[model samples]
Target: MRSIITISREFGSGGREIGKKLADDLGIPFYDKELLEMASKESGICQELFVKNDESYTNSFLFSLVMGNYPVSADGRINPDMPLNHKIFLAQFETIKNIAKKGPCVIVGRCADYVLKNEPNIIDFFISGNTAEKKKRILERYDIEKNKAEDFIRKTDKRRASYYNYYTDMKWGEAKNYDLCINSSKTGVDGAIKLMKAYIEIKEANADK
Candidate 1:
């Protein structure tokens, strides 16, 4: 309960629900889309921009060239002339760090694991499920037709993977990058939550020793 937890989940994996429930059970704050609001407030940027770019990456060569020459302020403020996408990213990055500094909480997606990688009390998790189960889950949760669920799931996962890979040195959904990897298809949502809680207990106990 003393460790900040960051969850990177595949589409239709139930990762957000697990993170929210776990945080509630542990009496800690939960952050997912809420991070966007915080970053908007912190950076004086519009929240709509963050929502538009949420968990998505842009690969514009021109923007990269421009950002390279963009001068950062001596006080470490983001350059106003930087691309909106990069500004939104930096805002979220700083917001994640500030949230971690506040206390232990559960954060879902948006490359929070990489944002807080150097923190002493951070636990990172990657949640994934088998393709069939994920598609079924997606069909149940969203209004999409059963025939299209698979494609929807695939596209969503691809977008998330691209975003994570673009921002972090680690590969998305790679086991070595996370402290624990949960297969929600095998364990179910409640089971996964239980496993995470037990792991947290052991980690905190070991840290105390």
Candidate 2:
């Protein structure tokens, strides 16, 4: 139960729900949009700005270079002199690191898998589902027509992929990048959670030995 989990999920796949349930089952904190709020609070940026710039591939390369890394205290606390946007990025990045330090939380999206790549006790998961199942879920959850659901699914997944691929060196949703890739449509959300729990147990046990 003491393992950081990063979940990268396809749109309409119920990835967020599974992450929440898994964290509850393990008695650990679950973070999603909470990450953005924390970042906003620390950096004095609006939540909308954080969301918009998050893992955004469109961020100007020159801007990122010019901004560079924000100053941090000797103890790694953020320095106050950095620009607002850099401060926001640093805050969210620090949140990811701090969450891992606190142990055993399920973090959703925001390229979390990449952010905490150096951590030893991490299990990254990519959740996806069949096209028909995903489309149905999107339609029902979003209250959209079938055609809109299909288009939404495609566009959303593309955005996620771009964000992930741009931020991380690895390909998004590739089997090798994640410790486990689950198709929730096969066994439903609860079943996927059970499978993940079992898998984590095995990995933990082997690591302990």
TM-score of each: 0.91, 0.87
- Judge candidate 1 at residue 132 and give its lDDT: 94
Backbone clashes for every candidate come to: 0, 0
Native-referenced Cα lDDT, model 2: 0.82
Question: Clashing residue pairs, candidate 2?
Answer: none
**Candidate 2, superposed: residue stretches over 4 Å from native:** 60-86
lDDT of each: 0.87, 0.82
Could you tell me the TM-score of candidate 1? 0.91
Error of 2 at 4 (Å): 0.4
lDDT score of model 1? 0.87
Over 18-57, each residue of candidate 2 has an lDDT whose tens digit, in order, gives: 9999999999999998889887877667889888876666
- Which 10 consecutive positions of candidate 1 have the poorest summed lDDT? 61-70
- Which candidate has the top score in TM-score? 1
